[model samples]
Target: MKSQRHRITDLRTRRRELQRRAATYRASKGTPYPVEVHLLLGQTYLDPASWDALLHSRGPAVALRRARFAPRYDQLLRRLEEAITRYERP
Candidate 1:
């Protein structure tokens, strides 16, 4: 039997693979991943551009990852948004 962490990690791994495949498909065929998977891996690293791309892809899997990882990514986005909002406030 797999440990819970292992199971979660496996799930996240699958999600990542799907995300990668989806990105490739979107680039080559202009489409998103066929299957939408949830459960984000805690250690995955994505740059802002990739994050934005994923968000804009509008795939359910992306949505799931967004929801799961929002707590982490959202903090950074929120801070950036706040800084922009403050800086623009002449």
Candidate 2:
């Protein structure tokens, strides 16, 4: 049986480890959006061009990935607009 102080110390250590994992993931992976999305965000309509074009230039796999990215990116932009509208009311 662990003492109360030891249990508390163990729990705190566990929490620190979990926080470190979370921080590392966010730093490395840039959560909520992929590197492809980030790269495209500044470009016209999030780059990618058209499905057929992408398939031709890049490949079927990249075309497929970018195809899914457009709508999700637009949805994220819409949500950002909504949040701005809701929060920035004068």
Candidate 3:
């Protein structure tokens, strides 16, 4: 009845608040790295062998080039994963 309606209204408000927080986070902390490269690095994190092979086929120097940014990508992934966990919490 009235209690149920109030519960629903409260949930909707919470949802809107979470959405706003996510939008603000994205605006302020968006990654400067290329999306394609980020996705590829994600896959690399998951499957090192496949990434190694792909990079190997591309060129020997390619891995060296990416090595410079490996730490940065790792940091970015960790931050993104933590953000996702926070967003998923009730």
Runs with alpha carbons beyond 4 Å of true place in candidate 2:
1-57
**What's the lDDT of the predicted structure labeled candidate 3?**
0.46
CA lDDT, candidate 3, residue 32: 42
> What TM-score does prediction 3 earn?
0.35
Those runs of model 1 whose alpha carbons end farther than 4 Å from true positions after fitting are 31-90
Which residue pairs clash within candidate 3? Answer: none
CA shift of 3, model 2, Å: 65
TM-score of model 2 vs. true structure: 0.37
Task: Judging by TM-score against the true structure, name the best candidate.
Answer: 2
Clashing pairs in model 1, backbone N/Cα/C closer than 3 A: none
- The whole-model lDDT of each prediction reads 0.46, 0.43, 0.46
**How much lDDT does candidate 2 score?**
0.43
lDDT digits (tens) for residues 1-90 of candidate 3: 343324333433443454455556556777343354335334424244644443444454654544544455446555554554454454
